[model samples]
Target: MKAIVVVGASLAGLRGAEALRQQGFDGTLTMIGAEPHLPYDRPPLSKEVLRGTWEPEQASLVRGDNIDKLELDLRLGRRATSLDTGRRRVELDDGSAVSYDGLLIATGATPRRLPGTDGMEGVHTLRTLDDCLAIRAGLERGPRVAVVGAGFIGAEVAATCRQRGLDVTMIEMLPVPLEPAVGADVGEALAAVHRDEGVDLRLGVGVDAIEGDGRVEAVRLSDGSRVEADLVVVGVGVAPETGWLEGSGVKVDDGVACDARCATSVPGVVAAGDVASWHNRTFDETMRVEHWSNAAEQARAATSTLLAGDGGGDPFESVPFFWSDQYDLKIQSAGRLAGADASRIVSGSLETRRFLKLYGRGGRLVGALAVNEPRRLMVMRRQIRALPDFDEAVAAASDDGSA
Candidate 1:
């Protein structure tokens, strides 16, 4: 390939570009990004950056000198408006077209917003650096913060707000936060941690609307209750940013549909990160992971597939892993936990807020969740790669001396 074009200019995009260079692809590499700033770490936007523990620059993914070494034809503040698969060209919002011998789509995702909340002051979504700064600025007012969605982002934001001595109210439509991912038992234990730290967690309730004359004054719940707040952070979830690929003939089911090797429907094109919904040979399932780890790992896999000519590369069968920090707790999980049918607490106890739980599906170990027990979690993570029998894995966990 003579030239390669990478969209997104995000963590995945940056990683993909680096992989292309490391894999000996000394081609004309063009990276087009909608944001003006270079790629930076996003995981800190909700924790270190929002909590004022780390400055914005501290979250940068690469140094200026190192990025210069990549020799990227970096086009910042330029959005890819559309793709033409036939001509292998990408049309930018600036009305310019860039043709490529290979393409990597790592556009990632956009956080979902509440209805009628757009243009409203004090209503924010934590996705970009500017979004984090805006929310941080609002935090200085010591406002009563209402965090919608009890997911990782919402939980982290609430925890950070409470640490700053601010009144925080977190609302979730489900009865327990993260129930779908880690099961109800584990999710409730996590919920207890938030309550212990004085977070007003309103579960099994949906946001009716954001009530205010102009600025966000309160959030009305579906159960006829109101959480009065000066600021609101919507973290309901995110949708993959695939609108630009609508008529490109590249399949998009939840994200850019790809094979196990990260090869998309269109030849010479591949996708990674939150924007790619690919088959995982490990779990024999199709998934799109939005976690920080998956973004970096999948980018390299996607790049390998792009260089290997579609089906020539090895399958990207990775065991997904993610971590989140909330208050005094450090939560980590590996493998697929969404469709788990059985789960068992293998180490520690939920009452103590420290444990390693194993999730199983179809009598095989499929996932693991750890709260404070990093060592045991990694052991389970390795065991999960072989898809051990559920009961035997549980039995092994009991005999493991390291755990």
Candidate 2:
């Protein structure tokens, strides 16, 4: 390929471009980004940036010398309006078009906004640097913060707020935090950590509305109880940014549908990271993960596939992994947790709020979580990655520390 265009210019886009170059692709590299700034890390926005321990600029993914080495054309602050697969061109909002020999879509995702909260001051969602900065400014006022999701982002925001000495309330429709991902047992165990840190966690309840006259004053729950707050941080996950791909024949369902090799439905095109809903050949399932690590891994795989041409590269297969820090606790998990038929605390007891939990489905080990127990969790995570028998995984996880 003489020309390669990567849309989105976020972590996945940056990593894919770098990997293309690293994998010996001497093509004309071009990147298109809607954001004006270079690709920066998003994980720290809710924690370090909100706590003022780190500056927003410090979250940049690119280093001083790293960006120049890629030698790619950057179309920053340009929104892609549509894609022309036949002509191999991308139509931008500015009425310009960029044609390419190969294309990689890494448009990433945007935080889902709560209904009736749009354009309201003091209500925020953290997705980008600007979003974090706005939330940080909201925190500076020392107001009571009400977070409207119990997922990683919401929990992190609540933790950061509590650590900052702000009265924070975390609301989740699920019965426990991360219940959708980690299951109720592990999620309940972790919720205790937040409660111990002085966070008011409200679970199994829906938000009726975000109430405010001009700015956010309070949030009403489905039970008719109102949480009076000055700041409302909504961390209700994110949706893939794939609206422009409609009618583009790219096959987007929640995200751009890709094969096991990360190749899209449209030939000569592929997708990675948050924008990719790829069928993982390793796990024998289709998944769309929004974690930071998945983006880099999938991007590298897509890059290699790009360089190898059609039907030439290995499929993308990596264990899904992510971590979250809440106060003094470091929570980490790997593999699939939702579809597990059974699970149990393998190493440590949940009474101590520290354990390694293993999950299994249909006799196969599927997932694992470590709560302030890193070493053993690493081993258990490896077991999950290996797709061992449930009985064998249990035996390995119950092994003594010497193992």
C-alpha local distance difference test of each model: 0.93, 0.88
Native RMSD of candidate 2 (Å): 1.4
Q: What TM-score would each prediction reach against the true structure?
A: 0.98, 0.97
Clashes of 2: 0
Clashes of each: 0, 0
lDDT string for model 1 (57-122, tens) is 999988868788889999999999999999999999989999999999999999999999999999
RMSD of each: 1.2, 1.4
The digit string of per-residue lDDT tens for model 2 on 1-403 reads 9999999999999999999998888879999999899999988988898899998789999889898999989999999999999999999999999998889999999888988888999999888888889888878889999999988888899999998999999999988777767888778877887888898989989999999998999999998899999999888889999999988999988799998999998878989999899989768999999888999999999878877788767889878888888887788888888888888777877777688888898999988888898877676767677788987778766746334
- What is the model-wide C-alpha lDDT for candidate 2? 0.88
Give candidate 2's TM-score. 0.97
Model 1, TM vs. native: 0.98
